[model samples]
Target chain A: MTRVRIDLFASLDGYASTTGGTSDNPMGEDWGRLTAAYAATRTFHERVLGDTSGTGTTGIDDSYVAAHFDGIGAEIMGAAMFGLHAFPDDPDWKGWWGDRPPFGTPVYVLTHTAPRPPIPMQGGTTFHFRNTAVEDVLAEATEAAGGLDVRVGGGVSTARAFLRAGLVDHLHVMIAPILLGRGTRLWDDLRGLDLTHKVTTEVAESGTIHVTFTR
Target chain B: MTRVRIDLFASLDGYASTTGGTSDNPMGEDWGRLTAAYAATRTFHERVLGDTSGTGTTGIDDSYVAAHFDGIGAEIMGAAMFGLHAFPDDPDWKGWWGDRPPFGTPVYVLTHTAPRPPIPMQGGTTFHFRNTAVEDVLAEATEAAGGLDVRVGGGVSTARAFLRAGLVDHLHVMIAPILLGRGTRLWDDLRGLDLTHKVTTEVAESGTIHVTFTR
Candidate 1:
C-alpha cells in the first residue's frame, strides 16, 4: 500500500507558513526560523541543500530529516508551493528548486492552470500539473509512487486540504520553540485529529519537538 | 526578589482557552483534554484535585506538575478564570474552588468590578478583587508573596497581559498532542518572544511537549 505522508514545520504558536515570499526569501524569514533545526541536520544538508561536507547535526533531528527523504517515490504539492503565484506570467520559470531539483521523482503540482505539458527536469524529476480534485490527483500520485510513499509537499493550505480530506497516512510536525504571532496557522480546522491517529512526540537535541501522527 | 511564574496548558494548535464554560465545566472540555496529562500527575492529584489515594502518574510530566505546586506564594488570575463571568451577579459566589481551595495563599483577581471587599475563604485562600493595572496588581501580589515566587494564573488573556507587560519571569506551557481547532490562542501578539527569553522544550511520556520560556 502506498502511504500518503506529510511533514510540516510549525512554531509553538502553530504557524505553518508566513507571507512575504520573494525569489530570494522563498518562504519568509519565519519559515527559516521554524525550519532552522531541520536545516541544521546532516540529512537536510546532503539532500535538500546538496551540502555533503557532513558538518550538520547528527542527532534525533537528523534521523527524522533522513526518514523524510527516504522511500518517497512521488510528491504532491500546491501551486503556491511550486511558486506559480510568484512567477505567474513567466512560462519558463520553474519552482524554487532549481534546474536540478532535489526531488528525483514525479511531482504532481495542484493548480487551476493545469493541462500544461509536464516539465521533466534533470535527475528523473518530472513536474505534472493537475487541476482535478485532491482525491483524483492523489490516486495518480499513489499510482506514480509505485508502491512507495507519496510525500505531500505543502504550503499549509494544501496540507490542510489533504488532511481535511482524510488522505494523509503519516503526518510529522516539527514544533519550533518560538512564537510567530502572525501567519497561516496549521491547526485551525484540525479538531480531534489525535482520536483518528496514534500520536507520538520526541524532544530533539535542538530543543525542537517532533510530533508524529500515524494512522 | 519574587519571580513571576506561570504554567499553561495548550493544544498543539496553541489554544489556551475554549468557550462553552458553564457552572459544571468551568474551563470547558477542551481544557480538560489539554490538561489531562497534568491532571494525571501525582502532584496534581494531591494539590489541585485533592486525591489522596495517589493513583496518578509519576513520570517526567509529574516532575513538572510537582514543581508547579512548589514555592507558589500567591496567584494572580483574571475575573473570568475565577469563574466570575459564570456568576457575575452572585455576590455569594466563592469562585470554583470549594471552601478548602487548593491555593493556601492570597489570590489576586483582576476585574474592572473590583473594590469588592476581600473574601477570605477557608485554608487561608483570600480572593482580592483588583480594578487597577496589571503592574500594580503584580506589585501587590509580589509583596504578598513575601519571598516566594508569584504565579500569574491564567485565562489566556490574563497571562498574556502579564507577559505583554514583561512581568513574567518563567512561563511553562504544556503542549498537548491534540488540535482544538477553535479557541482563544495562547501565542497571539507574542511575536519574537523567544528572543527575549530562553526557550527550552521537553517531550513528556504522555505525548505532551513541555515548553519553558525562562528569562
Candidate 2:
C-alpha cells in the first residue's frame, strides 16, 4: 500500500500564516532557512515548475521539500491554497501558481462549495474540486496515483481532517527559525490522537532543521 | 516598552496536539532525552504547584516546556486553552493544570463566550477572562508585568489577531516530529509583510531543534 504523506514548513511558534489571508511576515527568513534541502532537489523543482531564471544558493534546510517530492504521484490541498475563499463567485481562483502549478500531477482540492470545472495547466497538473469527506479525496488521490504515493499539501484545516481519520503515514517537517506572534496554528485538536513516530533530524546552514517521522 | 514574545512547541508536520489535547508525540526517545532539563526545573515546577511529592519526571518534554517558560512575566492565551470547546459545561476546564497551572504569573485568557471568573493558581498564576481585542490584552499584560515581558500563549486565531496588530517583538518556535495531515494549519493567509529577524538554531538531544528568532 502506498503511504500518504504531508510535508510542510512552519515557524518555531507554530503559525502557518500570521495575517489570516495575509501572512506577510509570519515566518520570514525562517522559511528561507528551512528550505535548505532545496539544493538536493533544485533540478526537480526547476523541472516541475519550468523555471530556470534564478541562481541563488540553495539553502540547507530545503532538503525535506526535495526529498518529499521524490516519488509523489498526486496532490491534495485545501480550498484556501487556491484562493477560493477570497473569490467566491469568480471561479477563476485556480491557484496562486499562475498558468502552471508546480506539481506535475493531478491535484485535488477539498471544499464545501462547488465551483467551476477542473482547470488544466501547462504541465500535466490538473486542479479538481472535491466536495466530499476527506477520505473520498484521499481515495481518489490514491487510486489516481496507481502505486505512486500522494502528497497532502497544506492549509491547516484540511490536513487536520486527514490526520483525524488516521490516514497520514510519513510526515516531513521543516522548522524555520522565526515566529509569527499570532496566526493560524497547526495542531489545534491533535491531543486526542495517539500518534507515534520516529524522528530523524538534520540542521541546515541557514539554521533550519529538517525533521521527518514515520507512522 | 515591554516587548511581547511568543513561543511554542509543535510537531514538524504541524500539530500542537492530537484531538485529545495531549501534545502530539515529540518524536524522540520518549522523555528520556529531557531528563536533565526536567530535573533542573522540576523543583520550581513542583514548588509552584505545592506538590512536594511529584518528584520524578512527568515524562513530558521538559526542554520544550522549559524553553517555553524561560523568560516571561505574564502570559496570555485563549478560551480554547481552557478546554471549553471540547468540554463546554465542565468546570474542570480550568486548564490542563489542576489547582496549580504551570505559569507562575498572571495569565489572561482572551475570550467572548466563556463566563467563568478569574481563578488564581498556587504559583501566582491568575487566569483572567477578557472579551477584548488582543491589542488591549497585550497592553494590559505589558503594564501588569512591571518591566518584564508578556507572552501570548495561544489557540491559532488568537495568535493571528495579535500578529495582525504587529504587537509581537519576538517569536520562538519548536518544530516537533509529527504531522496532523489535516486540521488548522499554522499559516493560511500571511503574505507580503516586511519582517526582518535574526535566527539562531541548535538541536536538542531529543532531536528537537531549539530555533529562536528575534525581530
Candidate 3:
C-alpha cells in the first residue's frame, strides 16, 4: 500500500495563518522559524519551491526528510495552498511558486468552487482538482502514484477532512521554536482517539527540532 | 479591559487533531518541528512550560501576536484542555499541564460537568469551569485580570463558536512544516467571514514561521 504522509507549518500558540490568510504580521516570531525549518529540510525544501541548488545538513535529520520525500509518488493539497483564489469569481490566482510549481509528480487539490482544467507546470508537475471527498482524492493519488508514497499538502481544512475519514498512514511534524498567538490551529476537538507510536528527536543547525514518529 | 486571544494547532491539511480528538500518527515525524516552533517563543515559552533555564528565540514575526497576548488579562479554554477528565465520568481530570500549569494568571474553562470549585496552581494559575458561553467566560476573565487581557484557549469547537460569534479581534499563525494527512481541522465551515487585517511574517531560529494580524 502507498502510505500517505502529511507536512505542515504551525505556531506554538497554535495557528497556521492569520484569520484572513494574509502573511503580513510582525508579531509572529514562530512562522519565521517554520520557514527556517523548511530551509533545513533541504531536498523537500528545494523541491517544493524549485530551488535545488544546495546540499542539506548531514546526519539522520536530512536523511530522514530526504528519504521520505524520495519515496513519495504524488502530492495532494487544497485550494488554500494556491492562495486565496478559492472562489469562482476571484481573480485568476496561481500559486506562490509562479508558473513552475515544485512538485515533480501529479498534485491533486481538494476544492468546491473554482475549477481549473489540469495545469501542467514547469517542473514536470501536473495539478488536478477533485471536488469530491478526501478519500476519493486519496484513492486517485494512490493510483496515480503507482507504488510510491503520496504526500498530503495542506491549507488546514483540507487536511482535516482526510483525518476525519481515517485515510492517513503516517504523519511528520517539525516543531519550530516560536508561538503564533492566533490564526488557524492544527488540533482542536480530538479527545476520543488513542494513537500509539515511537518518537525520535533531533536538533537542526537553525535550532529546529526534528522529531519522527512511526506507528 | 481584558483582551482574550484564542490559539489552535492545526495540520497543514487542516486537522486540529483527528475527529476522534487523537493526534494523527504519534509515530510520525512532524510534531517535533511544531514543538520546536513552540520552543522558539522566548517570552512565554520557558515561563509557561516551567523551564526557566533556556533562552530560545522569543517574539513572533508579527507584532499582532504579542499585541494580542499583551492586551490580555486572563484566559478561557475549553474542557478539552483538561483532557479526558472533562468527560462525563473521567474523575475530575485536571489539564495535561498537571499542577502549576504555565499560565501566569487565572484561566477559566468552559464546561458543564466538572468541579464547580476553582483549582489553583503554581505561577498563579487556576482552573475554573462553568456551563456558559465563551463571551461570558471572557467577561469573567477580564474582571479577574483587572486590566490585563483575556485569552480564549481552544479545543476546536469552542474556538469556532467564538469566531462564529465574531468576537475575535486578532489572529496569529505559525505555519509548521509538516502534515497530518488527516485529523480535526481548524476551519470546517468558516465561510463568508471577512478577515480585514494585514499580516506580517518573521522567521525564527527554530525554523517556525510566525505571522500575526490585527482586526
| Residue range A14-53, candidate 1, lDDT tens digits | 8888777667887777778888999898998898878899
Candidate 1: Cα lDDT at B114: 81
Rank ordering of all candidates by lDDT, starting from the highest: 1, 2, 3
For candidate 3, give the DockQ.
Answer: 0.04
Interface RMSD of each: 0.8, 5.9, 10.4
Docking class of 3: incorrect
Q: For residues A26-81, what per-residue lDDT tens digits would candidate 2 score against the true structure?
A: 33444443344453345544655565764433555444555666788889999877
Candidate 3 Cα deviation (angstroms), residue B151 = 24
Summarize candidate 1's per-residue lDDT along B87-186 as a digit string, tens digits.
8767788787888888899999998878788999888899999999999998899899999999988878999998988889999998888888888878
Taking all chains together, the TM-score of candidate 2 against the true structure is: 0.54
Preferred candidate (lDDT higher): 1 or 2: 1
Q: Each predicted complex: what DockQ?
A: 0.90, 0.14, 0.04
Candidate 1 regions with alpha-carbon error over 4 angstroms: none
lDDT of 3: 0.61
Which candidate comes out best when scored by lDDT?
1
Residue B43's lDDT within candidate 2 is: 49
Cα deviation of A181, candidate 3, in Å? 1.4
User: A36-107, model 3: which lDDT tens digit per residue?
Assistant: 656665676566655567765555446656765677789998876755553434545556656877678899
Ranking by DockQ: 1, 2, 3
Each model's lDDT: 0.88, 0.65, 0.61
